[model samples]
Target: MEKLEEQIAHLTRAVDDLSDIVARQEGEIVTLNRRVHMLMQREGEREASSGGAVVLGDEKPPHY
Candidate 1:
């Protein structure tokens, strides 16, 4: 029937729209993951160079 056809067409379009959104989000997640990994590596290097000095929130730096 025509009504059934209309419903199917609408559902198909909705599914396609959702698929596009999911694909876009997947790419964004990949980019964010890479950035996080790079930041972690940079922080590790900084800590190593600083002689593993951990400046906690309640404490001040040695120069302070």
Candidate 2:
């Protein structure tokens, strides 16, 4: 019975630790999603101003 109690205690602690990790991840995901949304908005504005041409800086010129 004592062994079973000890196992239960350990499992409870593990569950609590995992719950904290999940909570932290959820917060981080929210922050990252917000940042992505803002970036997309900015890109959309830039594209509109650039006459719908998507200019990727990595592209080489015709001379290349």
Candidate 3:
């Protein structure tokens, strides 16, 4: 019975540690998600102002 109690205590400690880690990671993820959202919004506005040009090539010389 004492051994069982010791095992349970060990498992409980591990669970608590993991829970704290997960909570911290979740907070960081939320922050990163917000930053990405803001950047995407800015990019969208820039694209809209640029008339949504899809061409991606260098301009040819006047002789061409």
How well does each candidate superpose onto the true structure, as a TM-score? Answer: 0.86, 0.84, 0.76
Model 1 regions lying over 4 Å from their true place = 58-64
Q: Candidate 3 lDDT (Cα, whole model)?
A: 0.92
Model 1 global lDDT (CA atoms, 0 to 1): 0.94
Report every candidate's CA lDDT: 0.94, 0.94, 0.92
Assess the local accuracy of residue 42 in candidate 2 as a C-alpha lDDT between 0 and 100. Answer: 97
List residue ranges in candidate 3 displaced over 4 A. Answer: 55-64
Candidate 3 per-residue C-alpha lDDT over 1-64 given as tens digits, one digit per residue, 9 for 90 to 100: 9999999999999999999999999999999999999999998998799897753565566697
State the lDDT of candidate 2 residue by residue for 1-63, as single tens digits. Answer: 999999999999999999999999999999999999999999899889999775877668879
Instruction: Tell me which residue pairs clash in candidate 3.
Output: none
lDDT of 1 by residue, 1-64 (tens): 9999999999999999999999999999999999999999998998899897765865887898
Deviation in angstroms for 43 in model 2?
Answer: 0.4
Report how far residue 28 has shifted in candidate 1, in Å: 0.2
Off by over 4 Å in 2: 54-64
Error of 2 at 52 (Å): 1.9
